[model samples]
Target chain A: MTAGPVLKGAADRVLAAPAAPRRKGHPGAYLRWLLLFAGGLIMVAPLVWMLSASFKFSYELYDLNLIPVEPTLRNYEKVLGDPRFLRWFGNSFLIATIVTMSNLFFDSLVGYTLCKFRFPGRTLIFIAILSTLMIPTEMLVIPWYVMSQKFGWLDSYWGIMFPGMMTAFGTFLMKQFFESVPDDFLEAARIDGLNEFQIWWSVAMPLVRPALAALAIFVFLGNWTAFLWPLIVTNSVEMYTIPVGLKTFAVEQNVDWEMVMTGAAIATLPTLVIFLIFQRFIIRGVVMAGLKG
Target chain B: MADLALHGLTKTFGKTKVLHGIDLAVQDGEFVVFVGPSGCGKSTTLRIIAGLEDATAGTVEIGGRVVNNLEPKDRDIAMVFQNYALYPHMTVRKNIGFGLRTSRLSRAEKAARIAEVAGVLGMTDLLDRRPSQLSGGQRQRVAIGRAMVRDPKVFLFDEPLSNLDAQLRTQMRLEIKKLHKQVGTTIIFVTHDQVEAMTLADRIVIMKDGVIQQVGTPSEVFNAPANVFVARFIGAPAMNLLPGSWREGGVALDMGGQIALPGRQLADGTRVDLGIRPTDLAISADGAGQITGAITLVEPLGAESMLYIDAGGVEIIAACPGRTAPDPGQQIRLSADPEALHLFDATTGEALR
Candidate 1:
């Protein structure tokens, strides 16, 4: 209670101080904050409503109430207990984890190589990798499916993971960060008797921790939320990832809004947890990119 | 400790050739400094010796073994970089002991070695601190300590003191010189500062445009410069050059005056460039020498004054007293002892001994 009074007194003094420079300047600051608040609320409305619906009954899904008139835990219970739903979540969890690990290692390794080494056609190779980012995912699905079929990877985790195990965007991001690890540090490591691979793993990896963190979060979320490719590639319902499995809850005549919303809410949890844990690195990476641009 | 020898070492980067066959021999426990202007390839030569970069054509022998194809670690050399490449994530103790990781020493032995190196660098108290927590000079000592703990055959320094501010640079120079005496390892230090070369090196190797210009001790390079470039590059305020044509017993300067040398004689009308150190060439109130000029500017360096004087339509630097600075645009006569005058070939720039 005393702490509350002290905080209020300090805040009052801060506002009443005529020496406060922000008071004399910053015209229309309140208006800017008001606009930002409105825009943020609009953007967040859908997610908030979906979360509210996850706690509602199937009949109350269309009520348009921000809060359920009578809340129920039945949808979560139904989504959690179903063996097929549990299988789909496990599949997504395995795929995203494996893909995130592969992207972190291989993308960073390729980036370190391209950035540090003086090789013929290095620029050409980098440009080629970047060019793949421009190609629409729709155009590559057929080739991916054919490759998966030929390799007998269809109806398996490999089919869902092979396309995004190492991403060009991730490679590009890691390369930009690794390029800044000074030649001196690497040379010092080499002189310290570390081989090239050890030098990369030991010296170079620690220097680009933020970039690695940012890339891991992005790759994990992207693979987790993926829908269309998993829908097309996997023939078995057991192989369906979260997004495709959530779609399976929507039938043509009898769509269970409550079950779908519950599955969607469950899928969103991991991404929210990851974002919270690594938000600092993500924001720093974006700010650094902005400054460079 | 072991000697280092570089034989016919050359380096090329595509169309640009950086080092043109450098050759030098460093004695055991000797401190050799490579001094030169930017792009002169001194650092490139040092890197080649450390096995950081492969030479285009020659072999580097350290301790009677040719290490041309060996990796940097196998070559048994440690380097302190200009930026002090200490691992920021590690404590000073860890960064110094990083090289010892690959060694077969036990954990207790490694800690003892780290403690020993930290003690030697007078940084025992700083070992627990991270590099970012230390001052610039402390970080420098840690870098030196890191190299020292390796006990390599040689220690290489690549412009290490260039990152320190002026006062810290001088202090670190002294520390490095003292450390060299304490460790007694063969050291190859590369820098562009002549003062650093003069103060710390047993032998200074001067380079320009990918070629070694001269190699000598501090006194020899300063007093008996090998060429016009060496003469000017070695000293602060630079050596003054006066255009003259050689004749019997004298040089007839282009300024319609003659500088008399009683015993020395050259071919009549042979073009020569008269080189005089600023400390040797001074402002004279009593017409001591034939050279005359109007003072252009005065630079007071506390101990001595440098007067930029215009002699015969050419601006030349001359030395003067610290307390008595000749006013700018004032007429003065320039004088120098005949024994201190350096004459170089006008065409070749080589000293005309």
Candidate 2:
């Protein structure tokens, strides 16, 4: 009460007023909402079809309706009942988890080094690493295969993960984020009696959490849904990841499309959850990366 | 805790030399201030002493041992940066105790040390807050506390108060001086603000163009500057320097006045500059003064006023009593005691006697 007048100043009142109402009354707003809703339907149609198909029987596959009239749990039953399906799911989980962990650790370490340390040829080395991003993955797939064969890593977890253990894109992302950490903080840490590694780990790393979270989500989702490298290197049924294992549903003569859709629907869950949880970071990280570049 | 000395300290970034052979000896528990204009290498000299930067050629000795090749941590020093550099993600308590991460102190001892420092800095309640939540002054206190917790041989402050507003800067300046008094640790503070240098230093090292111009106590530098640059830099409103040539009984001013040098004799045509503080120059109502000038501007400061006068072709600033200052366009005679004048060699700019 003592400071009531001051607290209720005209400027404060103006600022405390509610944000402008949504422009729903305008024709432009109506057009924008209509267009956005149409685009949303187009993007989500395939996902809706997949979900719809997962509930239908093989005979009902040709139906164009989004909701099946004869929906049954039999497709899920057949997909879950198979032992090989579970093995493939587990394999994908293991490979994706390991690959994501390795990328996060090695990429951030190399990024911190390339960004913070001063040494001869540092710029050249960073350039060399970044130059790899220019090379097409298809061009290097044969070499990756040859290297895996030479190391006897074919049909193994290491073969699927070796190429992605560290990536140029991840390194570039981490370095761009590390650039925001002040050199003064590092100097203060050094004067505080911290070694270079300690400074990087404690002071430098914590400051770029948003970048790290964004990187983690990107790597995790990329590996989780990865098809090309995993499909190429892995040979045996036991080693096939979800994407490769899902292919087994389509035989030479008869393609079990319903079962395939069921597996895909289940595989989509983890990535969807992850994306939902960290959607804001992804948007922020992308905008920041574009601005910084 | 340590007397520090720099011998032939020099730094070069590629072809540009930043610090050129800086030499000074700081006594144990002495508070020394490095004051200079920007690009004058005051911060660079501080960085080299803290070992954050490598001197191109010099040896830094702390407590009589060369620490040229030692890491900053190994050099037994702590630095407070201009940006504070407090870890944004860490709480104030953690930020202050960070230096102790490498110390062998027990957990309880480290906490106690942090608590004591926080108490001294009056940041006990704010210890749980992050730097983002703190005001500018509080963040500065956290930075000082972080440096204090180390209790190293010397404390290095690189223009630590430059980021604060004018009011906060003065308050923090007093706190830092009182802190030095209580802790009695050797401190090397770098600032371009002359007031900070004058009010806080036991000895002020004034530098220009990467070279130390004068190193002396506040009073010594204010009263008897080593050179023309020091004379102008150490005081507010700057000292008035007039170009002239030596004559028989005195120096004849180039702007139409002659100031007598009673007992000294010099070459008749030697070029010299006569320096006088604004405080020493007074307006003469009787028209019997060394130089006469028309007042162009009057800036009052409550108790005193600064008069910008045009004496012939030269501009001079004189301090006058605020209430007694005459209006602009009034012609006035300015006078100063011959004993209070400073004479510098015009060519070299070095003080003579």
Candidate 3:
């Protein structure tokens, strides 16, 4: 058993720790992941807090803890059981859906005309529409209110939906997308005996599906979370959207945090569900638009 | 199936005119190629005929009907694009049948036409594949198949084979020619490739700077160019131009030499340019010929060798048979066939004979 010098040397080296200088993790990579994780937490924290608050009683809201001491469905029960809350939810859903559908149709129509047709003032009209994107909603709120009042549309669905439907942004997005569509494709369709309308409807619309989906989600979200316009126009409780309906729950005497969180959660759900269903198209549309731009 | 006539067609974008007033008639089942450099308005003229772009002034007639105000579809013509603009989402079969389906055709009829076109283009197995899934050549075949299925009065191709690889381009070129022969449809092709134009066209319309330079058969343009531009543009490796002056009913080279021409009589001291193709120059072992020069470079192609010889203070390229190899710096005497020589006026670049 001459396991003397060689074995001893091997064992000593194997038992020795940290022979080479240990390298540290890259600070930039660690910072990047840290910032990403922090962003993830910051984005999800509010939604988590809202969901937790919705399932808690009014007393637990004041406790100010991450986890509820005693979780209950009492707030949701109150929010969902109320007939006004249900009606507001229905009203908001209906208005947003109608606005989204109309925006998809009308914006694409105007977009197609501006993109493909050779009529007089087409460029002028397109420039005019694009300029509207610069004017904020706050600037036009007074005029919009006056118009709604003049049209006798106060507290009506039309009042809430009219100003939001057929947005300049939707038309602009569609026009940009349609412009990138190779002219040869449209010409080929035309040579195939497809008229202008048929070309737009059958060929252009289907090709721009991702753009239309993106526009739909944007319009729906804008309409669903609309506060200022809906607030100014609607006076009747029956015509109240969820945001306006939630304001009624808040008073000088007492602010119902649980009910407010419940309403916020309800208002955010439709947009989230829509994003989930068309998430693939929305991401593709954004990337395509970015690359083309 | 139908003839097309472009009567005094012209187009202008803003104030810069792109196409001068031009007239051309494409006979039934004839293939006409518009060949030119970029900005030559070949594509613009084709687009105008297709009704995609309206001409600023002119009338386009197809099948004896003046279709100046009619839409592209009403003109009953189909076009194959350079990018092979097949619908990305549609399969080859659907892409081919799209036009038929849009018309008053039954489902069975559309299917039959699709099958017929697919068979003609050898795309039967590829009918179910999307354009993205097909190769470049396959997509080109599909584009042609799409055009064929329409059975239009005229077929318009806007550089359809330009996007393919060299090998595929050559292959598709033959396929398109064969397809045209089989279908017997009037086709107007636009390309900047001179070889494509020379090989495919029954009549080649050479254009430059938005104007027609010449219209002739391949040999006619090659042998009897209307001007120096046609002579320089028609031949590969280009025609060799040498400066000379008229001397005693013969052209006297600036390098102290003269060649006799029997019928060509020009004013004495009139400067002219002698145009000779590389293939027209013959290299003989006898040094007592017309011109002598030192070979500067020798390019040995498989079948023929191109000799760049320095003669008469100018470099002339001579294409000779590959069997005779000449070393660089070798003195070579080259004599061109007198009948093949083209003389152009030095001032106007117009033919002198």
The TM-score obtained by model 1 is 0.92
Off by over 4 Å in 2: A1-42
Per-residue alpha-carbon lDDT of model 2 for B1-353, expressed as tens digits?
Answer: 99999999999999999999999999999999999999999999999989888999999999999999999999999999998998888889999999999999999999999999999999999999988789999999999999999889999999999999999999999999999999999999999999999999999999999999999999999999999999999999899999999998688999988999888777899999999999999887685889899999999998999999999989999999999989999999989988889999999999988
How does each model score on lDDT? 0.87, 0.90, 0.86
**True-vs-predicted CA distance for residue A54, candidate 1, Å:** 1.8
Question: In terms of TM-score, which candidate is stronger, 1 or 2?
Answer: 2
Per-prediction DockQ scores?
0.35, 0.41, 0.27
What's the TM-score of each model vs. the native?
Answer: 0.92, 0.93, 0.91
Instruction: Classify candidate 3 by CAPRI docking class.
Output: acceptable
Candidate maximizing lDDT: 2
Q: What does the lDDT read for residue B47 in candidate 3?
A: 95
Q: Which ten residues in a row have the lowest lDDT in candidate 2 chain A?
A: A1-10
The predicted structure with the larger lDDT, 1 or 3, is: 1
Q: Please give the ranking of all candidate structures by TM-score, highest first, separated by commas.
A: 2, 1, 3
Model 1 alpha-carbon drift over 4 Å, by segment: A1-42, A287-293
